[model samples]
Target chain A: MPDEQARRIVLASRPHGEPTAENFRLETVPVPQPGAGQLLLRTRYLSLDPYMRGRMSAAKSYAKPVEVGDVMTGEVVAEVVASDRPDYKAGDLVTAPLGWQTHGLSDGKGLRRVDASSAPITTALGVLGMPGFTAYAGLREIGRPKEGETVVVAAASGPVGSMVGQLARKAGARAVGIAGGPEKCAFVRDELGFDAAVDHRAHDFAEQLGAACPKGIDVYFENVGGAVWQAVLPLLNDFARVPVCGLVSQYNLAGPPEGPDNLPTTMAAVLRKRLTLRGYIIFDFAGLFPDFLRDVTPAVRDGSIKYREDVVDGLENAPEAFMGMLKGRNFGKLLVKVAG
Target chain B: MPDEQARRIVLASRPHGEPTAENFRLETVPVPQPGAGQLLLRTRYLSLDPYMRGRMSAAKSYAKPVEVGDVMTGEVVAEVVASDRPDYKAGDLVTAPLGWQTHGLSDGKGLRRVDASSAPITTALGVLGMPGFTAYAGLREIGRPKEGETVVVAAASGPVGSMVGQLARKAGARAVGIAGGPEKCAFVRDELGFDAAVDHRAHDFAEQLGAACPKGIDVYFENVGGAVWQAVLPLLNDFARVPVCGLVSQYNLAGPPEGPDNLPTTMAAVLRKRLTLRGYIIFDFAGLFPDFLRDVTPAVRDGSIKYREDVVDGLENAPEAFMGMLKGRNFGKLLVKVAG
Candidate 1:
C-alpha cells in the first residue's frame, strides 16, 4: 500500500466537565485506500455541533461515542480523489461521514454527490444537510405551524434554527427567534427576516418573548432546554405542540440539576393544557426525507431560505470551536475547514 | 308547567380537602316539564366519577363547576315518565346529562335512547356510556396497542380503568393493572383477565410493578398521576406512548406540589428514551365517539365487557359516593340511584 498523509483529529480523552484541548488530539496518518465500490476522498469542511458533546462523554444517545482511538465523528463535504465504483469518478464533490479528517475512504455507502453549481459545496454540510432536514421535518411533521401562528426557536442563528424560522415563515406562521448575544439576535431579526428576536441572555427574556408573541406561542421548536423551556411553557397556547429536537443546555451537566424540582408542575401543565410533547431521532422518520429535500431545496435556491456558516480554518482548532459552540460562542453553522 | 314531586341533590358548599356529606344538600322539587323533543327521565342510576369531584369544586377545568345553588352535573340512566318528542313515551328507558335528581327533563339533543333489549339501561351509565367510550377511544386511538406488548393502567377498579384493561386485552396485548387494595387488585387479575395486578398502596409497589411485566410497559393509560406516575416513568420502555387522559391524583391539589421537584429528570427521560407524552380530552376527539359506540356496544351486550356498578340509592348519597370513589372505596362504577 502506498503511504499518503491524512490530517485527523482523534478523541484523546473523554471530557470530565466542559471539554478542553486535552480531550482531542491532532495527528497525520496514512490516507486509506478504496476497496470494492469504495471511494477515496479529501474532506473540504467538517460540521461541528453541540450533539458532539454527548459523543465526547461516553453517554448513551442515538449515536455512539467517538472512542479514545477513533477520529471524532462528524458530517463532511469531500471531493472524490479516486473511485472504484461506476456511480462516482475522481473530482466529484460529495457529502460523506468523513469525521474530522482531511482524507476519508468510503466503501460506497452513505455517500451522495452534491451539486455545487446550484449551491455552495459547504451548504451540503449546513442548510442542505442534516441540520436543515432536522428543521424541515420537525416543523412540518411535529410543530405543524399554521398560518398567523407564532413559532419560537432558540439558537436562532444556528443552521437548524435559521431554517426553522425561514420554513415557518414560508408556511405563513410568524417566526420568533431567540439567541444568546445581541449580534446574533439582530442577525436573526434583520438578516434572517424573523418577525421578532429575543436575547435569552437579557434579564427580561421571558417578558420579551411574551411581548414578541402576542397570541401566545403555538409551536415551540425545542433545542435549548433549561430556563428557555421554563420561560416558554407558560406562554404556550392550549393544545400547543413541543417538538423536542435537542437539549443543548443540559448536555454538559454531569448530574441532575440542583433541588426544588418542578416536575409535578410541568406534569400538571401538560394535563391541564392538553399539550403534546414528542421527542424523535431523525432516522425514525426517514420516509419523510425525500419530501423534505424537495420542499427545502427550492427555497434555498430562490433565496427564500437563508443560511450562515461559521467556518473555523483548520482541524486543530476543532476543540476550541466545539467548546465555543457549547457556550453559544460560534455564530451560525459552526464548521471546521479540514482541507483546501 | 305542572308540578310533580322530585328529590334533588344540590352543591351546599365546596369542600376544602376531600368532599363530605355536608358539601351536598338534599331537597324536594317539582318535576321538570318535558317541552317539544324533550323527555322526563326517572333517574335509576347516576355515575359518580373522580371528574365529578372537579365539577363540585370552584377550580378551573375543561368543564364548568357546579355552582353552590345548582345541582351537580352527571350522567344518569332513566325510565321516561313523559315526552314531548314523537320517539319517546312513558317507561321508555333513556340516558342523558341528568344530574343527581329523582326526575329531570332532557331535550333530545344529546340524549341517546338506551335499548333495554340490547343490554340493560344501567349499562348506559357504566360500560356503555361516557367512561366506556373514554376507554375505547383512548385505547384505540392513543394506546394503539400491538400484539403481545404490555399496557399499564392505574385505578383499575373504576369503569374507565377497567375498560382500558379489557380493551387492551382484546387488542392482543398483556394488561397490567394497578389498584389501591388487595381486593381490587385481585378483581383486576381474576375478573378483568389482567396478566398481573399490583397494589399501588403496597410498600414495594414499584418493585411489584417491575416484576409484573417482564418486557416493560409500552403504553401507559395515565389516570392517577402523582406517585403512580413517578413509579411508572422509570419502567417505561423506549418509544413508549403515554396517553394523558386524567391526572386524578393531582386534581384536588390547591396549588403546585410541595418541594423536591423532578421536572428535569422526567424531561431527561423523555429525551433519552424517545418517549411521546400527549394530553387529550376524550370529547375533544369527538370524531371518535360514533366509532367508539359502534365497536363497544356489541362487546357490552355479549358480556364480553363486564362492569360492576356501585349503586348508592338516593340523590343525597352522591357526595359520599363521589368522595369514596376518589379514595378507591367503591368496588366498581360508583352511582347514585335517585328514584324508583
Candidate 2:
C-alpha cells in the first residue's frame, strides 16, 4: 500500500552564521495525487551540497533564499510513482529539484529521467550528477590544466573534488587534493588516484601543500576559500587559472573576518601573475549537461571515475547531516536516503 | 655630427612609498655604437606608464625589478640612426623597450618599425601603441561587454582608459569613465564621447558612479584599483567581467590599506554574481597586436577615437612627471620627450 503521509524539511529561520537544527523544521503532509499532466515523485535519494548554505541566508546570492515556511532547496533522485504526463510513467527513476521532501508533485518540467540500468539510481544525485558536472565544466572551461601542470582541489573526498582530481589526471596534469582528515586524505590519494593529498586540518598545512606542489600550482579549483586560498596564493604560478566553484570555508561567516585587508595583496598577485579567477555555478553550464552525461556516465560505469557517498537514513536527519557536511564531518558525497 | 654624449635616468634608490627625484639619478654616458647585426637607436618619445612603479620595487612581479643603478625600464619611440643588419633601418622610426635613455642599442630582434607617415610618431607611444593595445586586448579577451551593457574604466583621460572607453563604445556598450577631477571628467564625457563620466575626487564619488551606471556595470576595465574598485563592486551586474590591467591607485602603497577585510566580501560577490576577474599584461596578447592595429588605427585616423598626450620636455623632467602622473597630475597620456 502507498504511504498516505509525506514528510519535508522547511526553513524555519534564517541562520545568523552557522545553521542549526532549529533553523530547519520537519513537517508531515498528505501525499497529493497527480492531477492533469503532473507526476507524483517519491524521493529515493536527496543531495545535500554546500551551496544550500547560501540559500538558507537572507543575503542575496545566485539562488533565491528559502522563506520561513518554504521547503529547503535541494536536488533529489526520485521515482515517479504515478504519472499523468506523456513523458513520465510509474516506476521510472528521475532527478529533479524537488527540495527536501519525500514526495513532490511535478508538472513534468525540468525533470531528467535517470537510467537505472547503467548505474545505481543514487549515482544520479552524485558521481554522474550536478556535482560531477560542475567539476567537469569548470575545469574544461576555466581551469584547462595542461600536461604536467599541477591542479589542486579542496574537499578532496567529496564528489566534486574527487571528480576534479580524476579529470585533472586524465588531462595528464598532477592532481593534488586537500581534505579535512588523514582518512579522507588517504582515500583521495589512494582510492581516487590523485598525485598527492594534503590534510587541510594538519598544523603545517601550508608547508605541506608547498611540499606536495613542488612545481607550484597551475590550477586551483577553489571551493574552500579562506586559509586554503591564502595558502594557495603564494604557490600559484604565473598564468595560473582559478575556477571558483564555492567558498565553503567562508560560507558560514556572519561578518567579515578580522582584517589585515588581503584584497590588495590578492589583487597584486593577480596582476603580477596574470591569473584568471572566474566564479561560476553549475546552472550556468546547464547547456553542457548532455555532454557531461555522455562523457562522465561511461567513466563512472567503467570504474575509471569512482565516487563514494555518506548516506544518512530518514528525512528528519537531513539538517544534522547537512550541518555535519558543512563542518567537513561527512566523508564523501553527502546524501539522505529519504525512502526506498 | 651625432652627439657623443647621452643622458639616461637610472634608478639611484628604490622608493619606500611614493617615488621621488632622489630615487632617479641623471647619468651622462657616451652614446652606444651599434655592433655587428645591431642598431643604434635615438629616443624620440619615452612612454611613462603606471607599470614602471612595479619595476621600481624589489618585489617579485611578471617583469624583473629594475635593479638600483640600472636605467629605469621604459618603452620608447626611437629613430634607428644606424643599422648593420640586412633590414637597413637608417632613419627609420621604431618602437622598442629602449629604457629611460636618450640613445639605446638594439639587436633588431624586438624592434617594430613605426610608420611615421600614417600618424604622428608620438601616437605610437600613446593611441596606436602598447597602452592602446593593452586596452584592446584586455577588453576583447576578458571584459567582453555586449551591446547596451554598461562598461566602466578609471583614469579615463589616460591612454589605456581612453582607448578602453572608446573600444567599449565601438562594441555598442555604454561607456562610463571615472577620472580624477571635473576637467578630466568633462574631457572623458564630452571630448572622448563616453556616455557619462564621474570624478573620483568628489565627496560622493561612489554615489555619483552608481548614478552614472544606471543599469549597473557589465564590464569594468580595472586599471585603477583601491577605493574605485570598492565603489564598482556593489554595482557589478551578474556575469560582469573585470579585466585587471593595473592597480595604479594602489601602486604607490607601501602596504595594504586598513580595512574590514574586503576579500571575503569580494569573493562572495564574485561567487554570487558569477563574475570573472582576470589580470593580464600586454605581452600575454602580443600575438593580437596586428589585429589591434587593424581595428584601432583606422578609427584613430578618422577621429572616431580621439587621444591626448601630456608631453613633459627633456629626459631630466621624467622623474618629476612620472611621480606626478601617479598622483593623477597629468591630464593625458604621460610622455617624456627625450630627444625630439
Candidate 3:
C-alpha cells in the first residue's frame, strides 16, 4: 500500500436541532499501515441508518456518541487492500465497522467475509445485515405478530421497515406500511407486497391508517416515532406489542417538543388496553443473526423478498443524503458509494 | 322472600374532577328473590379500589363506567342467605361482584367460596383476592424481577402495592416501597420487610428514592402514576420492566395536565434504555389465581407476608374513605365493613 490517502468525514460539532453541513468536516489523510494481525480495508459502500443521527449528538443514549474530530461511525462494505492476517487477503471483500472513511484498518476481529458471488456486496449492508436482522429479531422476539393480526410499521420503504412489512406478511399477518409519499407508498404496496400502504404526508394519514387496520393493530414495529406513534397509539388493541427499534422522527430534536403532555395519556392507554411497549437495539438480539440470514437470504434470492437502494454517488454527499433520509426524502435503503 | 328490604348506594352524578358527596346517593329498595340456580347474598364487606374512580366517569376504559341511578360497582364479601343453587348453601361465606348493596341475587356462576377458617373472610376482598393476584401475575410475568434486582412499588400501603413489595422479596429481589407518609413508609419497611421505604410526601422524595436504590430500579410496580412516577422514571435502569397496573393519581383528573410534554422524552428513554413498559388488568391473568393462592396463602399464614387493613366501620362513610384513599389518606387496604 504505497502511501494511499483516504477521505473521511468527522463530527465537527453537535447540531442544535437538525444537523447542517457545518456539523460535518471532510478531510483527506494518509491511510495508516496495518500492523501484525491487522487488515487494511478500502471502503466500497457505507450504510446510512437512522441510528447514525444518535451517534452525532453528545447526549446520553444506548451507544457512545462520536466525539468532535472523530470519524462519523457507520457500517461499511470494503475490500481488503493489504493484510497482515492469514484469514484475509488483498482484494477480498468484507463487511466491517469502517465508519465514514474511504479506508480502515481492522485486526481481523469483527470483520466478516462477504462473497460477492452469492449476492451484490451492497446487500450485505442492507437486506442481509444489521437492519435486516433487526426487523427479524424485533418482529419474532418482541412484536410476535400472529396470523391475521395487523402489524403496522413506519418508514416503510427504508431497509428495516421494508423488511418488517415483508416479514409480517410472511408470518401471515396483515402488514400496514406508512411511508412519506405516493411513490414510496406505491412501491411499498406493489413491490414489497405489504397488505396496505398509507402516505404519512397525506392530510388524512391517520384516517387512512385507521382504515388500513380494520381489526386494530396487534403488533406495531416502531421505527419512526412522533406523529406516526401518536396515530398508532389509539389504534393499538388490548395486549398489543410495540417493539420500539428507533425514533428517527425525533432524533434531531434538541429537546422535548411542545405538548398537551401525552405521556400520562400514553401510560393510561398502556394500562387500560394492556399494551406492551419495548425498546431494543439490534445488538441485544445478535444471537438471531444467523437465523435471520438463513430465513431472509432464501426469500431475497427467490424474489419473495424485494429490496431497493437509494445510492448516493460519493462519500462527500453522505451528510446531505443522511439529512435527506431523516426527512423521508430517500426512496429506500440509503447508502453512500465511497469508492469508484 | 317476604318484602325484605336492602340499603344501597347508587351513582347520582358523574364527578367533574374530584368526586363530591353529591356524586353518591343512598337509597332503600326491596331485595329481589333468587331465581333457579341463583343465591341471595347479604353484603358483609365491600372493597373500595382506585379503579372505582374510573368507573365513576363516562370516560372510555378497560371496564364500562357506572351509569347514573345504577348501584356503584364493587367486589364484596357476602353471606349466602337463600340458595337455589346446589353449590351454595345458606351461611356460606363467598366473594362476588355484588356491587354496593346490602343484598344481591347472583346466579352463583362467578361466586367463589371463601375459606374464613383458613384466613379471615375479608382477606378474600384483599390480600388473597384480586389485588394479591394482580401483584403476583404482574411481577412474575411482566416485571420478572431477578434476584438482587431492585423493585420499586408506589402506593406501598395499599393492598396491591403491599403484595407487590412482599412478592418481590419472595422472588429474592430488593423491594423499595414508596408511600404517602412516614407512617406508611415505616410499615412498609418494618412490617412488610421492604428493603427500603421512601415517603412520597417528602419535599426530597425523588432524592430519597435515588439514595434508597443504589443499584437503580429494575422492576417498577406502577400502581400510582404522578409525581412518584416522574421520580422513578429517571432512576430506572437499562432494560427495566414497568408493570403498569393503575394510575390512581390521575384517575380523577378531568383533563390532561399542563406540560412541557414529557411524552417524547419518555419514549426516547424507552428507545435508548431499552425499557419495557406494559399495562395489565388482573383479569387478563385470572388463570394464575390458583398458583397465586398456592404461593401467597402460605406466606400470609406463615407470617412471611404481612397485610394491613384500613377497615372503615360503615358503608355510609365509604364515599369519604374512597375519596381519602384517592388522596393517599388510606393507611392500608381500604375496605368498608358494610354490615355487622
Candidate 4:
C-alpha cells in the first residue's frame, strides 16, 4: 500500500476570466484499496476539454463546478489494477470519469470496458469517445444537413468540429471549415477534405467565409460564439439550422462586452430568416451512442473520417493544455498522458 | 369612373424610428376597371398587424418592404364588386392580399372565398385568419408543450398571443400570459382563461412572473422581444422551446440599443439549458391551414376559444390604428373598417 501512492491535481481556487496555474495544486496520497464490488483504476490518458473551463468557474452551467481543494473532475482512459468485483479483472482497459488522478477507486458503476486491440487506447479518450459522440449527435439531431446544403463549422481542427464537417460531407452536403491559422486551415481543407477552409484570425476572415459559402450556410455548427458567430449570422440562409454545442470564445469573459447590443438583431435575424438555433450537451443524446459508433467507426476505419490528436504528457501539464484548448491553441483532440 | 373612386393609404416615407402620420398619405383615385380574368374587390375589413410595422421601414425583412409612394400592403376581407373571372361573382365575400386600398383588382390567384354564414366575416381577419393560424402552427409545431408543462406567452392580449395561451390550456398545459397593463393582464387571466397573467408594465414584473411560474417556463411563445424577452430568458427551463413569431417591441428601433450586450448570455443560456429558439413567419406553416381551421374552427364555434377585436372605423384611420398597435395601445386584434 505504501508503494501505491496516487499523484493528483486538485482545484486550489475558482478561476476569474482566464485560468492560471495558481488555480491548481498537485498532491500525492496513499491510494485507497478497492472495496467489495469495486475496482482500482490506474489512469492512462486524461481528456482535457474546453468544457472543463466551465467546471472551473462557479458560474451556473449544465454541470456543477468542481469544488475547491477537490480533485478536478474529468473523463479518463484507465486500466484496472485491482478488482474485488467479479465482472472486472486486473489488466482490463476501460474508460471512466476518474478525474485528474493517477489512481482511482470505483464501484464499477459508469465504467465502460475498452477494446485496445480494435483501436489505440488513447482513441477511447478522443475520437471514439465523448468529443466524437458530441459531433455525431448534434449533427444528426440538430444540424440535419440535407444533401447539397452548405454546413459551416468553426474550430474546424478540433475533434467535434472535424467530425461535424466530415459528417456533413458524408451526408452529401458541402462542408466549410473555419480555423485560426494557415496550418490548421490547410489541415481542415487538404487533409480533412472540407469543401472550403477559412482562417478566422486573418484580416479578411468574414470576406473569405462569405466567398466560401456560395450557396449561403444552411447548417452552422456553432462552437466558437463571438466574432465567428457574428460572421455566420448574416450568411445563414432561411430555415438554416444551428447546433449550438459550445461557446469557447466567451468562456473566459468576465462580463458581457460593450455594445450597440446585438441580441435584438440576432433575434430579428432568427425571426426573419426562420432559423432554428438549438443547444445541446452530448449526455442528452447518450442513447444514440450505439448508432454513433456504428456510423463513425466505419468511416474512421476506412480513412474517410480523419482525426488528429495533440497529446501533452503528464497529468501536471493538463491545466496548461486545457487553457490552451480554450484559446484555439490546441490543434486537435487534446489529451494528457497521466502515466508513463 | 367618377363614382368608382378608391381611397387608399400609401407609404409616403420610410420611418427612421417610431412611425408618424406624416409617413402616410391618403389619396382618392378613380378605380381601375377589371380586365379579363380579373375581379374588382371592394375591401370590407383591413387587418392591421404588428408585421406591417416591419413593412413601413426600408429594412430587409422576410418580405419586401412597401416602397415609398406605394399602397401600404396588408391582408383584407373584401366583396367581389365586378367579375371578369368565371369563378367569382358580385357580392361574394373573399380574402386577398389587397393592400390598404378601398378597391383592388385581383386575378383571383390568391383569393380564398370566405363563408360569411359560417362565422363572422371579421373572424376571417382575426381568429380564423393569419393571426389564429400563426398561434396554432407555432404552438403545435415548435412549442409542442407536453401535458402538465408550463407555456408562457407575452403580448397575451393580442390576436396571436391570446390564441397561444388558450391553445396551450386546451393541450392541458399551464399557460402564463404576460400583457402590457392591468386591464390587459386581467383580460388575459379572466377572459382568456390563462393559468396566470403577469403585467409587463408592473414595477416588479420579473418577480411577479417568477411567482406565477413556480415550475419554470417550458415553452415561451416569443412575439414581443425586448424587456419581456429579457425577463423570460432566465426563467426558461432546460430544453425549453421558443417559437419566435414577432418582436414588436424592437421593430421600431432605428438601431441596436446600448449595452452590456446580452447576446453572449443568450447563446450561453441556449447552450447551458439546451434551449431551442426557432423563428417563423405564418406563411412558412401555410400548409397547416386546413389543420388549423379544423382544430380551431370548432373551438371557436363551441365558445372554448374566445376572441376580441379592437375595430377602428374608416380606412383613413388605418395609419393611426397601426401606429397604436405597434405601441401596444390596441387592446386586442386591431382592424380597420373600410366599408359601411
* All candidates in order of lDDT, best leading: 2, 4, 3, 1
Scoring the B chain of model 1 against the true B chain gives a TM-score of 0.94
Candidate 2 lDDT over residue span B210-254, tens digit each: 999999999999998899999999999999999999999888889
Estimate, for each residue in A1-340, the C-alpha lDDT of model 4 and write its tens digit.
Answer: 5587899999999888999999999999999788888999999999988888899898888899999999999999999999998898999989999999999999988898898877778877777899889989998999999999999999899998999999999999999999999999999999999999999999999999999999999999999899999999999999999999999999998888899798999999999999999999998998999998887777777788999999999988888888788788899999999885
Candidate 3, clashing residue pairs?
Answer: none
lDDT of 3: 0.91
DockQ winner? 4
Every candidate's DockQ is: 0.50, 0.78, 0.85, 0.91
* Model 3: per-residue Cα lDDT at residue B305: 89
Fnat for each model: 0.53, 0.82, 0.88, 0.93
**Model 1, residue B244: what's the lDDT?**
86
What is model 4's C-alpha RMSD? Answer: 1.0
Quote the lDDT for B111 in model 3. Answer: 84
Candidate with more favorable, higher lDDT: 1 or 2: 2
List runs of model 3 lying over 4 Å from the truth.
B1-4
Question: What class would a CAPRI assessor give candidate 3's docking?
Answer: high
lDDT of 1 by residue, A294-336 (tens): 8888888888888899999998888889999999999999998
How do the predictions measure up, each by TM-score?
0.91, 0.97, 0.99, 0.99
Runs in model 2 deviating more than 4 A are A1-3, B1-3
Q: For model 3, how big is the iRMS in angstroms?
A: 1.0
Clashes of each: 3, 0, 0, 0
